[model samples]
Target: MAGLHLAQLNIGRLRYEVGDPRMAEFIDNLAFVNDLAERSPGFVWRYEDDSGSAIETRPFASDPRMAINLSVWDSVEALERFVWQTVHKRFYGRRHEWFERMDERYFVMWWVPAEHRPTVQEAVERLRHLRQHGPSDHAFGWESLPAAQLWKSARCA
Candidate 1:
């Protein structure tokens, strides 16, 4: 660990408004999954508003239907465990029912200082970098780089 936290941003285009009956199941599970992530090992922080989840936040100003999730984890492994090993996995499996299949990259990851809390603007820039340039040290995808190398590269950035 280089005292660098992993910052991740994932955007999804909703199939319907969150309050719609069609999205009830997904909306109903938000709190449980959010609580699970907060309690999970190595969890640091997540983007939230008065509603307690960022699902209502629209990072893409042009797309009201887009929902964004941004979070920081102590390490890649910690994030992977939370997403793949917990009850959240069930929601991940059913994501297609609520979210549209995006043609472009919907997620991006980067390294930040331990104390840094990334903003939505920063996340948008990272996602843009990933979309425009593919994966690089500055912005990457789910396929991660070695922590040592990633931290070194991030520092150089």
Candidate 2:
């Protein structure tokens, strides 16, 4: 617990191209939401490009519309508070307006050294592991809360 951090990666497919008028609202609010995260209590670090936005960094090259978000937090509660108790909740509730519905898992959480900054490729592999093998100490999600806790216990032991 003293030397670890929680890392999260979430991916989504856009309903339209970045320049499309329909995506204007989401695009405009991106900076605001990202800023909120940086100012939040448990914020550690977030992946950003030269434009200060990760939207254009398409890790999934096969889908140009896919967007990825990777960040580190002090704890799960910190991330949850920022997500559910902030303006982000509003935009998240309206995700259907901008992102397509994916039957597969698109979000993942894992543990790493406190000083470690996870890379896109590493996060992608964890996500893939979760999608293919389900939740484990390797990677988990909100739906698999127990696995998240399991890692902490294992580490302590």
List per-prediction Cα lDDT, in the order shown: 0.84, 0.86
Candidate 1 on 22-56: residue-level lDDT in tens? 99999888888899999999999999977889877
RMSD of each: 5.6, 5.5
Counting clashing residue pairs in each candidate, in order, gives 0, 0
* Shift in Å, residue 137, candidate 1: 1.0
For residue 103, model 2's alpha carbon misses the true position, in angstroms, by 0.5
Could you tell me every candidate's TM-score relative to the true structure?
A: 0.90, 0.91
Best candidate, lDDT: 2
Please give, for residues 32-98, the per-residue lDDT of candidate 2 as tens digits.
9999999999899999977698988999878999998899999877887777778987888799899
Worst 10 residues of 2 by lDDT: 148-157
lDDT, residue 91, candidate 1: 81
- What's model 1's lDDT at 79? 79
* lDDT (Cα, 0-100) at 4 in candidate 2: 90
**lDDT of predicted model 2:** 0.86
